[model samples]
Target: MPDALETMKTLIEEINKHNYAYYTLDQPSLTDAEYDALYDKLVQLEAETGTVLPYSPTQRVGGELLKGFEPHRHLARLWSLDKAQNHDDLMAWHTRAQKLVNDYNTQHPDDPLPPLSFVVELKFDGLTLNLTYDRGELVQAATRGNGVVGEGILANVKTIRSVPLRIPYTDGIIEVQGEGIMNLSVLVAYNATAAEPLKNARNAAAGALRNLNPKVTAERKLNAYFYNIGYADSLQFQNHQEMVEFLRDNQFKISPFVKFVDSIDAVEEELEKLVAMRNTLDFLIDGLVVKITDMRTREVLGYTDKFPRWAVAYKFEAEEAVTTLLDVSWNVGRTGKVTPLARVEAVDIGGVTVQNCTLNNMDDIERKNLKFGLGSLVYIRRSNDVIPEILGKVTEEADGSEIVPPAVCPSCGHDLEKKGPHLFCTNKVGCRPQLVGRIAHFASRDAMDIETFSEKTAEQLYDSLDVRDPSDLYYLTFDDLIKLERFGTKKAENLIAAFEKSKQPDLASFLYALGIPNTGKTTTKELAEHYRSLEKLMQAEPEELITLPDIGGIVAESIVGFFRDPAMQRSIERLLAAGIQPVSEEAPAIVDESSPFFGKTVVLTGTLTIMGRDEAAKKLEKLGAKVTGSVSKKTDIVIAGENAGSKLTKAQELGIRIIDNEEELQQLLGDV
Candidate 1:
């Protein structure tokens, strides 16, 4: 019999060629049964010989454990939507938007009005990946890491069967955003032989995407459903939904669950049907994504730093997993801060089997007072891939023993001291876990965004480069990285290039990347705005910090404490010593009040010549009006634009006067 390694090598090459033919060319030379037999043989060989390559087909579902991902800067920001949990929240959002448009029409009586309409779609539960295509050919793929940055997983993404190597459209550079989903049937089929089964399609997709082997990614049958063309200068579409249809016509795999409705009632009915059928379908869908239909409307609605004002995601409840808490352990960090972690019996949650979850701190452990030490019943929930959090303690008899914080550091024998909820280990310089985690965070998405710096890479760098602080990243040479395992000359060069790019980031982004407690992206923005410079921020007093909006007392205190720390202060100084330029905030836009439509309440009824009803409302808003939803006496002016709807009849019956088009509104504002 051939040796296991030799058998695997042969099977891998065969399977890879067949996969390329089946997925890329849509022409399979082998039959389904024949393919299965070959795959089974490869699996059996791997099992018998214990020799598996990262790029092998068997590794596509997932691979060996990942230390962490290398960070890459996003061409455009990946903003998460502020979720609408229920009907009331959705209604409230609509009402608030209505008030803005209504106020505009009321003040500007010369503008035409049209009925407001909303477009809604499904929100798929899967890994959010951004694809950039240059001249219709796929270039790179990235995970949505921290909205502004992500991990580059091009190798794995290239293997997805549904993801086209080249889009049909060849006008200019295009950036498409969508969900990478693993079908339900494929997950079930793959899990049939596993000792543990996957929990959900979304998780399976996530795990598959992160797999090291392209062959493994291929077998998972991962598919892409393009939702929106994030950036395409050459594209022209009247509405967002129309854009999807355009992409579909261009041969891109577009989302299947999309519908247009004239009334809110129709939307509700569609949503109900979707929710009922979602579980029975071949994919996983967590919620509904709703947006204004018109493209012009979308442009006018603009966006916050995080989400588009015109769009909202109605999300469902988080999935739960029940397991046994086998044991509890505490570990101390470099700063001597101790955190409790729950060791649980493996139980599946959201398509991933989780065996452990962090208890966060001593306060969390005390609050739960968990009994499942040896075999207590426990519950887990996965939020992103950090860990399953212990929601509650179920039974005491099955509960393991009472886990307590150790007086000494778990990694080092040095003593621990309690400060607030955390127990910190006094031995700062030598703590291995702290060294690894701290270095990783410094190279994280919010920090320097080093694209090729994985946890394994960090470990390799630590022993060789002797990196102790954030500044050490700037000193890494290409030659230094090339020596590491899996780091080739080209890969090392890419890593060095990313590090160079991060040297000149905005001040807000730089501060947020610092990983300080209570100081995240939003707060970092505030600090950057208030101080305008790193030097000024560093010198600011606690009283000054407390004065800023959203800078709460606790956050203010944390900021002050962080600055006071000698270690943190030294790190900041080291970063400044490096040639990093923290950008200053530009002056805020001055809202002019002398506009003709200022304070008016506008209610649109139909479509207009220049823009859609929603788009017209937005223009009215720019002129300073409170747009409303329903027609009532509170309405100041009703713009009866083209294709007037029920709101127009109501306006006419109420004797609320209307204009003809956006031109009249503009002329009344004295622009014409």
Candidate 2:
């Protein structure tokens, strides 16, 4: 009889051989039953021996769920590529690269660099992954997070059969980077039986890679296409083609869309071809990455602060669709600024249903010749996965009826006043939409922390109780709420309790709750931090307001004008008299420079068991921190509560500081 270890090795090698043939080559050497027999034998041998190799197939079966992903620092940085949006931008990039090469050649006439040649490859729309292999063993796998340090998802990555566990190259360590994607066909198959279907392929792949459970990741049946050799200790490729060959030789999936060209014109021609057949591919690609083929040229060109100088991503134009402009509807906002919303015939842009588009005002309408575009075929485009915007009429002739401007406010029947490029409803005191919007904003989680308050509650209060302003909410009696429809005795008590509790608010939230025309949450927080008190902010001048970061001339003017209004001033005084006391950031303890949270920009994501996110934000604010809605480069720290999704993922991608545990957060907030 063969030894246990030797038998296990034989089974592992045989099974892996079949796995490579099946997964990598898209050809199975053995039948399903035959492959299962070998796999089952390997499992049995491993169980009997009570040992499993790091490269064993059984390891991919997945074990216990991980608490959190550990950060893996890559040996080399994964640089981001600069983007060229259009033909003009691409030409500009080419021009800059040629100039830089020319200058370098001029300086080194004796040993000049090779002529500029390029390789264009499809930019896969999926999560970036960096796989590290040492002595033929797949040692680690991580997401290309900040390019420096990423979350290690090795166990999750192992579930991907296409990813080789052991390579032929056993000489040294190598780090390879690629995109992890879920094929469109596989997604369709999975969705047929899935209880909750995935919306898109790109998201499915990314979500799978970021999931804590390896079993969940395995179920996605993801694929990967490696293109770049990020790092190596002993191996090196002279050019892009050579690198592609190396990746292919190692059984790595190389995208077949790679094109090599020596001239800029040839690159442009290839780009045009790619645009034609982009949608035909099984995977998703938003753009094409153009890189200098010669490794020496790339090294000589070096890198900029953010991207490599030798590579630039040529981004395709936003998806466009032609649809008939059915009608134009004018609506009044919380600030009485009336805006036109263009209603279009139902159309699909990049898989999303589009019916509504934005037409800024009279100026935009006239500029785009959209006024005469009513009932006409109009061009609408959705870019960067955002809401679609109208790109004007498709034809020159005014073939349809004109979109007439509103004479009176739709909600209040007041005369519409033209202000610069916009139409304003001067009926602020009587507009139902404006009142309801304002009341909802005031009772929002970020504003007053009014629990159980919704838009329906706001509308009901507006109609029955004649609640005109946000301050009117503070005066709502339990008796008044008890009489309303759907309001039980307990509900009335809870609402009143919420209102009374909201009377004590922080200065920043109180400012945001007012819904200043041009000021956002950031601006409101800045104002609160600088001035510390509501009275001081009310007394702020345009000059003083303009000094803060991101505060432009328009925002400063808006702040001054809002405070100057007698109605707004009177409303603020009414709230103040109603026992609403906004706590100022005047405490010396809050401004402590040594605290980690103080002066940092923070974001809170997911559900918190200890306290509400709004409560956490309030506490962070009191410690001189600014809390925001989204995660960006500017975000200093991220407080990730349980089940944190994309925001947490983005934070990890940016290598932003994350506090995943509530206890860790409690300690930080507790220390302050």
Candidate 3:
């Protein structure tokens, strides 16, 4: 029993250390298989000894479902920060802070204040969460509701792997405040099967925490980063920066891009840097938080009615504009999804003229209470400085008119279908928008690589010729293309040549060009790698697809559904009948033993001057080298180009050999 207990203790400590390294540090010493072995051993020992530690890895498994959320009062008020929109407002706030500090220094002449330095941190656009730990164990987690009272969400918060269930410190009480955010990549993956896809990461995190099922929250993969000490009974720090350092020392995740600056000018510069780096971050950050570094100064500054006076949030100017709603146009995508596009009076937002914005679907229109009227004003936002969308109705004239979805497809005049939150056109063959979109996608550079095909060409072919589907492109004669606008003898010959080239696209590109729902470039590559041929992929069952790596239930269902469709099957047969054949992606041939890059993993980063990134990767892979997306210890070489980012930094850190240009890469590959 003593031996078992000791083994369990060691395993628990080692697993927790690995967890900290993987989650908090973004570095892992142990492989996933190694970690799993240790975890399995610990579970077995704990089961035999009947001694389950509170911080055991088993406790992280989410299975509980709460009946309802209970209200809890916070120990310390989670005050909201005052916000400044522009540099002038920030300077005004700085002036006020300096005056208050000068007054305090004058009153206490013996203990005069030093020049104020500010700690600037990114203001994450997420849900504010307060966590309370008792005796080193996480006891309660709650939302920041009304600053004083909030709903308990301990079960949901515990499922977030980044939030430590138990810490090393056995302090009396430690209450920390932070933001709960959902990664953009996780959100995109989750939305593949979600009935009602979340609009943004902020709302997704908020909804996940407030969910009644903890398992659902766990599946969403929410992450948290502690930023402030709300109430700690046994901890003290001289300044906010020191408190942040203490949080980091305790294995808590904090913002990586924090800096201390002595003046408002420096703070402004940091804010500019933060804004420039915003799109590069995994999570959303709308602004920067400037807080006075001195704890003594903060004590003197105190609070206003709703916010702390010592700290201010400098928010970036919103990429939004109010525009007049003129009309709504429903467009059909390659998937037959009929999405509504709002035609608005032309207004400039962030230097771009925004005439049309996405309404998403009927559910979105209803949720925003959007009505079709000439006098109605709508608020549109360009999220992430891209993707223009109508946020909500700003002001609506008292018109009793409402925007209703069309019962028939606008292009083909066929009945439309509604599934979940989306409306779809059932006319797969005749719908102009759907056909145009599919043809355009099929001929895209990343798909079938038909270089001569364009949207205008597709439309003209659809209108004038007997072309109805992608298979029809192969049957088009040179005479047919010569009759089209701007199509002389040379252009017609080039079009025929491009069509011939597209008949034998690589397997991955052909799969992607088929317009399978929920399948992106990565999924297509995985499909090609697993099945190797189109016939095998088409015959794959959902059960078999789900067994493949990264192919979840939703993706498997989508793949099976696409192949099972009678129309899709018929289209495939027609393509085969028209002599369209796709070349399978075969394994790279083994080069001579003298080749330096043989069987080695290589990573390429930055903009290659000689060739595109994809072309470079393909070239390296063809030389018996495994091309990887990231740099690690296993990476044999990193081919870096101009303006390389984190991969280059990681390569340098790992002491991996880095080749500067294509010439160096060729030299290593023995192609020089």
Candidate 4:
């Protein structure tokens, strides 16, 4: 066993490393629960052993405030916004702009309304950066740095996986301006695990961008969305929307919320829609930025000293709305945590109707002094899009009484237990909601993708065929499926076909379908790749698992928990018996010395036409070349297929040469 001092020292180092990854780099090495557990363990060990290190992660935020940045003037000066504080002010601003447009049109009605169209983009609250490229290769990158002279951060920016080091756009020379944002998911997950949680996405993003260590910035997983063509010669976009599309086509991540509007009324309507749907998006957006779409119109309107005359941000009003509270309901999610949901009479707030909002925890209820009794007035507001929060009591309850935690889960009536701030229903193996959710998730498009097994069918299968879980689906007979309501011979056959089809799913898809808590598709794929087989993954030690990127105590624990359950183990056995084959890494092909690629280990990803991936592997094997599925140090060459994802980039990052077509692959084969 490790000594107390050694253990504390190890934990401090680990946590410090994690902090650098999260706060500085934006990539979290641990899940929320895992990080919390680690922090708690460090705290406990420190208290017990009294051997705290001076540089302990528990003591301070990992990053240092930058001393200064050398300013560089932008080709096109970047400007900040002047806010229209309220809706009335926004309306007044709009009215003034409309009058100016009308006066211009009145003077020239024959000019086709001055071609006035507008594009609305979300105002992302994050750091700004400008990137420059020469002949498709990224040459320089800089922070906005007071919108004048900025720090040259090409080396640091190159480390960001999403930011293309070489511009994918075919254009000769271009300058693009964008926001580097910390993903809301990344922010939420990091905050959940931090001892000192982040205040908001903007702060998290800002902190990550300014870190002195480039490696720290690299890990932050900071994503950039290009919003402007800062300066581009010999390239002309007809409109702002076209410019946005052009940027997106060139592999730059652009805002999906952007929309083109024909008139001010349409812009207003779109803004209202965006506000209503804000709670559904997974990013922090302050408001809607409406920019005149026509390039000529934009040129005509030009810029004010510090703001765009042709563009304005329509800000959402601060949370302050009264709605009658109905009864509070407790919902048990797939993870077993019971979330408190408040059902309220639908009330319009900032031109959007909100009837129900989430109460994050019991602490939130206490904070709001929320009561369950009907006819209680409550205030609701969403801080960003993380959750719809209850602000406070709007009025003393006509029948005011504090709401108590539900003794049982509202979904399945299972007894609840308190776990920190959360209320959980410990019906892990017995819960029907979890069963449905898991089953549905397994057959989702990203998983095994059994399209025939609809949710309703799964529910019917559960009830009529006594198939309560994912394992039971494999045991289902054609007769059992045929007997169900709306089930015909064709439909039953389709279900069987889909089930049979799933039997050959790759290891990544199979693991993803298992619905293990904290094990997302990416992590599942990583696990599958690392282990190359289900048996190895099932038997993986926690120490081994914790070493994987993005996998930590919670995921390891969850994986162990899944394997530990006798029923789950039996389910795996049954699925295997039903002919399911998890994919494994293709072994290196034996190349004869005479073959062109005799010593080459060629990797392939995405769709291939000359042969299927498996068939291509066989052919390459026959040719005396090694064929693998993923790119790594051993990969001598990467033969890219259509719609190839990040693996191509990985290959490039490793300095491996890439080939595009089967003809090029053939040429490589001939090179021997």
Q: Whose lDDT is greatest here? A: 2
Which parts of model 3 have CA positions greater than 4 angstroms off? 49-51, 192-196, 321-379, 382-672
Compared with the true structure, what per-residue lDDT tens digits does model 2 show for residues 401-498? Answer: 99889899988999989989999998878889998999999999789868768898999999999998888888888899899997878778888988
Best by TM-score: 1
Which scores greater on TM-score, model 1 or model 2? 1
Weakest lDDT window of 10 consecutive positions for candidate 1: 59-68
For candidate 4, lDDT tens digit of each residue in 243-322? 87787666576787888878877878888888889867766677778777878666654554477667787766675677
lDDT of each: 0.71, 0.86, 0.82, 0.71
Per-residue lDDT tens digits of candidate 1, residues 441-548? 777766666676667767777777788776777877888888878777778888888888888778888887676676667678758755778877777778878755
Q: Write the per-residue lDDT of candidate 3 for residues 89-138, one digit (tens) a residue.
A: 79878887787778678888999777899999988877889999899888
The model with the greater lDDT, 2 or 3, is 2
Candidate 2: clashing pairs of residues: none
Per-model TM against the reference: 0.68, 0.58, 0.51, 0.44
Segments in model 4 whose C-alpha atoms lie over 4 Å from true places:
1-320, 350-352, 371-375, 382-388, 395-399, 411-413, 584-672
How would the candidate models be sorted by TM-score, starting from the highest? 1, 2, 3, 4
